[model samples]
Target: MATTWYAPYVAKASGWLSDAVNLADMAQGSTVNLAVTGLSRSGKTVFITSLIHNILSAVHNPNRMPLLNVVASNRLMGTWLEDAGANRLPRFRYQDNIEAMAAGAPLWPAGTDDLREIGIEMRFQPATAPGKLLSEISGTPATITIRIVDYPGEWLLDLPLLAQSYAEWSRATLRLYRRGIRAEAASEFLSFMGQHRHDEPASDEVAKQAHDLYRAFLIKARDAYGLSHLQPGRFLCPGTLADAPFLWFAPIDVPDNTHLAPNTLGALMQERYDTYKREVVARFYEDHFRWFSRQIVLVDVLRALLAGREAFEDQRLALESILQSFRYGSGSLFSKLLWGPHIDRVLFAATKADHVPDVQRDHLAELLRSMAAFPAIEAKSSSARFDVMPIASVISTVEDTQEIDGQRVQVVVGRPVGSDKQAKFFVGTVPIRPPRPDTWNAPFLNVPVFEPPVIDSSPVDGVAHINLDRALEFLVGDRLR
Candidate 1:
């Protein structure tokens, strides 16, 4: 009976120990957050869906050999499943897209402002013993939560404003509208800037008008810029003035003294740009971006390069600007904020590589490396992850071959809307590694085969199954693990 008394104490101690173990497990299994950003029409949505699909496929498979093999080989833990906030991550939903898929039509994404958070649970099956396999597949399951924020790419431009002043932002915006390869509508905003500059000692109404004018111009440029996927969040809306007047600066104009009222249009534009950059973009970066552990920056490298030299240079400068914005360098104030944490890994992808022949895939990676231009890191240990891989989101499904004299060439065919389809040879080579400066001189197409599509379905003459799986691997592979 005396020895039995110790049993109660042991049970009490074990209860507390169990609670402690649960807490530790939670701390170790903290949720992983990822941000996916790319240019409009890049395969972001498809990639995310494919990643989820593959993970689900692996989880639900009755034949547990792959899981067993991975576990036995130490590639993974046991497998299980959880609700990846199935109802929450609306952006990843494929049900709405089935109509477009079934019809063999190009799919447009849902509007941007209405982005939804998606949560999925990744079930982890713990390994059997140190060596032995309990079962080829595990009957038990453990889970980790994955949270993702799906926003339209247009919103990505707002991230860099934290560092810029309104004047600087205005000058920069004006320069881009004037010298950049944007649509002509952007010029109208400049006229407003010119007028506001002549009004001395500007009144609040003048400043507000300039702010509204600048926003209107941005909206017009976005609409007319031939990039139709512009409506993400209404952050660009002219009148959400919670902290509105702060963004009421004007663009700076060169000195052309004609009966001046102080605070000219140039001044007004500069101030508004500064406020927008600082208050708006900075706030977004602070609120939405802090939790990201990984990020993928999708770019249209080939498209920009193909637009010829000036366009290429503009894109190059834009890339540099973007990279500098994200980097946690000495002068980067955002990085110093509680919300501005250093990104663990960043993957810069060249999208729609499938549009070109396989032979030139490596060249895309090389192009990306050249474009990245070696970000200035806080430390060498502060990793700057980058890659250039071809992804055909909406695949061109034709195996186009043509006879050039005596030689036969397999090509990819591209078509403008309502235009005749033209063929470009498929470069079978896939990208093998990240590009570097030295790689730039080499042929862009010679890299190793990254991943090729399996071609699950038939093409609609010119349409094909894009290498979306490869994109998924590049984007969420590590996260899946």
Candidate 2:
């Protein structure tokens, strides 16, 4: 691991300037940077699209979001998207996504692979009397600019690589692959890696072969076996770096104490790994992550549960590892003034709650909390407020009751993807905690993909959801005041 190259220099030169600019903004109005991320196929795109729709819609139809205090108190005056400016990051396609969902035959928006941003201006009356006095004196309503950033959760799994040496990462990754199901899926790649000699001179053909096989294994582990702990996530979703040599290295098996000679395969691989951390991972932290004041980590608990015991546990480990990136603690004012942004609030949300019956939603939330209780994560929990809840950004199912074996069972009814006919799905009760090996003997739950419910084209009606307002209130409610 290497120290971020620019940290010390930036701390010394820009500390006061950055603090003053932030303080000045806070006096007039506040800006909140909200980061939303989740694993592949975790419905992040849908969540963002639905959230924006609901907020903009609440401006005209306050009744749609009664759980949000600003709306319930009749203080939400207006909401609208502002121009993101030219030559900046691309804007999130809010209209295109909503239109797809509202079409005669709705479809889910495409999943995100690149970074995008959207800014919304929320104008509202001040909730407190003194704040109201200030607003009246200024002849303007209080405003908060909410900036939402969307990116792949795969990229997030790479953050921990910043603190790990190539040798350390290789040993850990190799050990993980030898475990229960991963051993079988990763056998081909493992065999190839074992055949190479790390001390030998570097060869492009050999390196490419190793990289290709390892990438193939990652894809199989994710798509076929439902594993979540894959590393160098960009290999799986290589947005713009598809052909770059920076992504051409693979982990090699080597003795812990061995030293590599110059120009050897081991030396070349280590150099590329260091370059990756210094360039790709560090730039992301500096540009995007360092500014986020609030974060939402979405999890597809139901999918993991359905995948079986091995997958459920793997997903848990991946989440616990990912949480390390948010572990900054409260420190001295001087340190805070000089340091980059520290996240004060984090929301670990179990998405697709609509896939299960209402009675089982609490179990979903509890499972997430249990997964997030790793020792390292719990230590950070003391510094920041962590909230765990179940949310469905878009409600695609309606509840119904069915008689089974002389008993009534709650079920969710919706149209499965690619099918014109609607069907009822019943996933067995979700465990409140991770189930032990012996107790996890139930059949895999057959949760079906659901089509989005028909929605009116107007944003005022908004999109139907579950717990989205409560989640929003917890993340940025105080800032709104």
Candidate 3:
């Protein structure tokens, strides 16, 4: 009986050992699993589409990605999207998204709500001595395969659950739901909790009702309040596990250390919660996330700023919490063998840079750095290369100037989605650090969602972008060489 359960883990450990041994082997080629990490509305889909398109375009016109060393040096020989096999996850809808953005009335692609991966193949002339030596032996340009994994940001908020018991998680989560703006969003769930005691007899219907209310609260917090830190993420984006029995439980009012009697309601909920943590959260780490060698944590900083102070602070906490799930540091054979591959490079990007003028873009990036507490994260993981920048997957607005209240102000010009004419929008002065509590006095930003600019269906001109090349260079430049 023990052998059956232990056999899978033994095989997994053996595979990990072999991979660790081959971590430094580049004689054949290299593979980069680029985890496109983000929270709700962080523009993961658009970023992936733009990145793939730009890479393919760079093969024809190197100017598209001049900042990437491989392209600027003119050593990039060819680039193409890899064909997804049956074993692969759902392929990212790159072409469908491109066509939509190029339509008569363009629409931005849908946000990522399911797991998907897209691969890009790059053939490059060897720039380093070792790479040249390997290519000479193979009689061809060296190759690199980049795999990008995209999933719902809601699930990201669940990573911290791996460390908490069901009761501890319940206490912490219930406490959070009662504070500040969340108090109103979770009113129904809290009211429901008041009537249902953990000591009651086990009832699936009652437990399922609690789960329904919690799921409703998450949507309310997200849609109505712009909140991102919701737990049990599968409730929001279940994908294939929509009907899983283990997800039918919700946090009930209970003591942090209390273990209810067997066959009681509390015990049933605890069983489900433990099963969820083991089967879902831990499975994600072992199978997909831990193998990622690089990461890009995208943030919709502009939108978060406009969402109000409570939301802005909530996003900060959520991002910091989500970042804890990643293994950061330079990977060694021993470390990889024990902890799988650590993400040696991390890029934190403020998405939608086109919403701000060039003068304020750097400020936006700086604000994101402070919001994510990048310096502290860097200080802890000294060996990993961490950088933050402002990037627009597709430039949607043009820089212009406008006078407001008899003062000249830098602004961006674009047609808001529903508007018939273009208008200038000034986002006001962006601060380099998190503003004081007293400073969030009023909404200084009056920006609107701008229509996506005309884009080519093919990678001919490569969709107009802001600082994407520079970001990509920081992510995969070393591997290219």
Candidate 4:
């Protein structure tokens, strides 16, 4: 019975688990591998840039993050980056991003395209009385090494696929594509599938063709319709896996209970799908996600609201899929010792709060909470803390009032990139819940890509933001204390 049971365990958890296990780290300092999980263009890069900048700037202008308990209590001594040589992962290009943003003509940093990690050291005075007394006696400054990990957002949608078989996933994807705006975009792939049977002889060429067409449809659906729920999520960013055989397989029509014969198209697909689950998806889950004790899930709620009813519904389904896929819970003292650590705290934020007026920011957060099933997700695990809020990592607009239809409405003024003239945009009233069919009028909002404000590359003049302080407080305050 030695090999009878598949011993479920972690892989490459040595460096990852050290944050939880190493006595040296536990005694002298602690490390929190905070994972930033968000869909593409959800301001993850900007958030990371602003967060690190502000943390370094806290010593200069404590006003930037007054809500962070460490900063509020004046316990934050200073912050600095750790050596990148310590970790084998590629370093996040923070200075290059800052330089790009701080150039004579300002620009926002590019979104994350790879798996990068950065470690920041925060030296602070102990917040707890006993810890403060011990710190005084030992004459050692309390420390926390915050290692932030960022990866392509498309990889996030892959989490749900881990639970689905090739047939099940194909069925669901085809069914969803047949309805709403997706049908038009998927017409080519659907028509291609109409001529091929799943039981046909497996041909590498045919499989690759289908994968290409399906990928094209996914790209079209995303670009033309602003859809974010596409699967095999890494298709767009092939990277080194570009020509991998596992990625050559695509969904085909197959019955739920029908057996895929050996060397059949469906069998190849099923095999490749399983291989992908075991190799690609599982590796990410083990190497990165499992190590995270804290996570920030960023949602561009305003973009969903602006992308029309169908896209909004698509995002809703995506959020629901994520909720159904992952169980976020804190490990008990017993469980942590036995099975390592689990994500204990999560912050689900509605990104780009600057798009809405001050009066509507809470509405933005509430709308995101509803869309993401925040309350229900939180209720499932009382031990874990899941909070939803609206945040703008980089403030790019100024608020003003304008008369619209004989009523004064709040508007935001910003210089949209590639245009010299500043535009005043009045994003329509955002709903706190999904809108009824009749109420969802087309062209609800016009969100423009604004240029970054004049910024000082020096950390002392951290970029302006909204609710970022509170977000930090929720994320790492306990560790500081």
Candidate 5:
């Protein structure tokens, strides 16, 4: 029986099993690849920068947090910065553009259109038996290596489209935007597709008007819908075809009603979209990812809910879709059969908790639990896993909220991007978090000058507890053995 093999089964598990009949080969120093992905400008880079700082700066003197305690309590478990071999790890320095983000200007992140890699090296010290034979290492540190990489979140959107075809994608795309929340863009796209229904236009008299109109519609749709995922950079590429077919076809309300000319704009765009699904998305699924020991999915839950209920519901559906895409051996599975072990645990992190006080962070976690269908537990499950914790990295306290008399206003405070003199308008409440079980509210109605701790290029005031350490343990804890 020749079955259609999704990437996860064929590329990940199949290859892994063939290489390791006894599974001892599977035990070769476990590699943990943690991906921080979401929509564009969603603070991924900043979060990653902050995470590195915490891990490098965290000391073992205090066992207050469970993460360091796990390392400290175990005599055999030790950690350190690793040698990069010929490729040395870069200094844990801040991105020069971060200051701009801290100010008011939004960042478009460096490698959205292209693929880039950032690696960090960590030297590990494994625990040894106290009274063992000659080879037993005791009271001495051992060395192992770990690496972390950062990539563009927009690439993740393609994971779902891999299973779709040109006609299926055309229909689904039209249906998604037509009646869905982003309808205006759909209507405009469909109108553009209506233009080149018959013969392909001749070169000298190519129907550029329709193309220009469609591009304008895409721009407007992007602005209206906050679609940072749209690859406008590709549209503006230099050369002849740049002005041709792709610029003309828009998302259609009724693609079935429109006639697609064999050599016209509609045909070209439909082809490109399909090509993107197969070449970029499917290729990545087959070759790039391996099922890991653990996964951390960062979600900006509050921002989604505040965007409005429709956006809120849409986000919830998107979360479900994303989880479905990661299922092992499914039609949408991403790993190959010979890949690494299946992910045993998934950590759903509610990010940006610093905006609120510490007391209410739990509420954010609770809110996430309410939104998702499967909090945990799925088919083809791996070992020991459960949902736990809501965390705020790079914690900080707000100094003041700009207001006049009783009227609230934002002033332009000097940040990274703008040349304004006044602080931006703000809903005043210094970020503060109390101990657990206390609800999130403005606890400090009268406190003045709440300052955050000093850490070079840190995103928030103080370092939140257990964020980086716990991430390390989850990603590489088993590898030491």
Candidate 6:
């Protein structure tokens, strides 16, 4: 019997047919893929946990989410967790995290470094009268499946590498390391780089040593200096790629427009860099990112501001680089079919909003807006509706007014993490724009990490939050309707 190539074609056609059916089902009762990410310690886990809790709770007690139209209009009929097939992805530990927060002695949940997902099915009455009537006649409410994916924000930093050549990235990264505080932090790594000759024959020992020094510098830059623009993000969160020799490459001071000799240190690093982008970054986009129709990028603005000007600017640059990877637009049918799903809505939220007084919250939002106005980001602003706001996923503080210099100043009172006594915090004022050099020297902003408040385990009561409901409404309100 002669073999035929039609088997592969048949499989591809079948996949397309399946996708068409899925899209049809989505149109009737939408399935939203929501991707959430943030820098280290940016409260990504807490934000996701609270979002799920509030949505599940809102079905029973609409008051819990008054800002969400479905809940506010009493259209949210019910909610339940659908088993995300055991083999697909690791399920998010929603119950375990909720227990930690709602326990007798509330504690913050452990940070997640790996990818996880959860599926929630929401049954709701349609916002439109005709749709509601149709649902009533059928005796079945409309249902939407929301699949949320959580991953480390560090991985997001790797997206920009897809567009740069190894030599270009090396020169750019090396140049960046020599500036301001990065110079101080990268001193050890730079010294190690100086010892090796890029044109010399490749050696595994030298390559691993260089990688270790550079990774160490990246770690210190993030932990000690709060720099956020570090590249090869996987270096910080290796995950399964930890022992992969392909990741043991570091940027070198290769001259622009220079061709590296074959089998040299530069050539080996370049090859591995290309392999990393192909095997690691490209796969991530195809598998996870291309499916997301909505995204939330959590920014720990207060922490960056406190870190000083260089760190703040680095964070702004990092955000600009990361956002470039997202396909942002008013996606048309042709574009959607041809280009895959683009993120229709993106929310750049300043997390830990409760740390600031109410009077300063708008300023925080404005600052984030300014950060997002970078040239690269501004171009994408028109493609998709971009929203910048301040949100506290978990309200860890309470508002209070304090007498300062014989004047009543708004402050927030909260128990600092690891402390039993409550203390009031007033971080002067947040500037609406990036501060000038002189202004930066004024008052140091010292915002403490506050312990999370006690949360009720029941969904009816919901978790305390700031602007979470409003944020949710802006991201997926139209779809819910």
TM-score of 6: 0.90
- Full ranking by TM-score: 4, 2, 3, 6, 1, 5
Tens digit of per-residue lDDT, candidate 2, span 1-481: 1223433444356544343232223237677888888888887888888989999999887777888999998989999886777625778888889999999888888766777889888888877654464466556778888888887788878877877888888888888898888998899999988888889998878888888999999999988888898898788877656668977888998789888778888888888888888878778777777888898989999888888889889898889777766765555221342257677788989999999999999999998888766445546543456889999999999999998888899999999989979899887788888988887654364568799999776788898899889989999887666
Q: Per-residue lDDT for 375 in model 2?
A: 45
Quote each prediction's TM-score.
0.66, 0.90, 0.90, 0.91, 0.64, 0.90
lDDT of 5 at 25: 18
User: How accurate locally, in lDDT, is each candidate?
Assistant: 0.49, 0.81, 0.80, 0.79, 0.45, 0.81
User: What value of lDDT does candidate 4 attain over all alpha carbons?
Assistant: 0.79
lDDT score, candidate 2, position 114: 75
- Please, what are the lDDT tens digits per residue for candidate 3 over residues 1-481? 1223433444465554232322223445567888886876778999999999999999877777889999999999988988786536888899999888889998888765778898898989978765565466556777788988887767767777877777888889898898988999999989998899888999999899998898899899877887877888888888668689899888887885677888778888989999998898878777877787888888888877877888888889888776665534444222332356577888989999998889899999999888875676577653467899999998999988888899988899999988899988777888888888888844333448789998888886798898889998899887888
Query: What lDDT score is found at residue 437 in candidate 2?
Result: 86
Off by over 4 Å in 4: 1-27, 325-340, 443-446
- What number of clashing residue pairs does each candidate have, in the order they appear? 61, 0, 0, 0, 43, 0
Please give, for residues 101-214, the per-residue lDDT of candidate 1 as tens digits: 334444433433334455555555433331112122223333456665655555555555555544444446566666553435656666666664434665678777765665
Model 6: lowest-lDDT 10 consecutive positions: 18-27
lDDT of 6 by residue, 310-428 (tens): 88889988887666655444552223422556777788899999999888998998998887654454465545567888999899999999999999999999999778899999888
TM-score of 1: 0.66
Which 10 successive residues of model 4 have the least lDDT summed? 1-10
Query: For model 4, how does the per-residue alpha-carbon lDDT over 1-481 read when each residue is reduced to its tens digit?
Result: 1311211122142333323332233237778988886777888888888888888898899999988999989989989988887696788888888888999999889766667889999998876654564466456878889999877667767876776788999898888888877999999998998989899999888888999999999988877787878888778656447678898877888887988899998998889899988888777777776787888888898988888888888777777655442454443222331244567888888999998888889999888888866676567653457889999988999999999999999999889999999888777788888888887767343469998889899999788999898998898877887
Candidate 1 vs 3: which has more TM-score: 3
In model 5, the Cα lDDT at residue 19 comes to 29
The predictions' CA RMSDs to the true structure, in order, are 8.7, 7.0, 7.1, 7.2, 10.0, 6.8
Please give the range of 10 consecutive residues that has the lowest summed lDDT in model 3.
16-25
Query: Where does candidate 6 clash, by residue pair?
Result: none
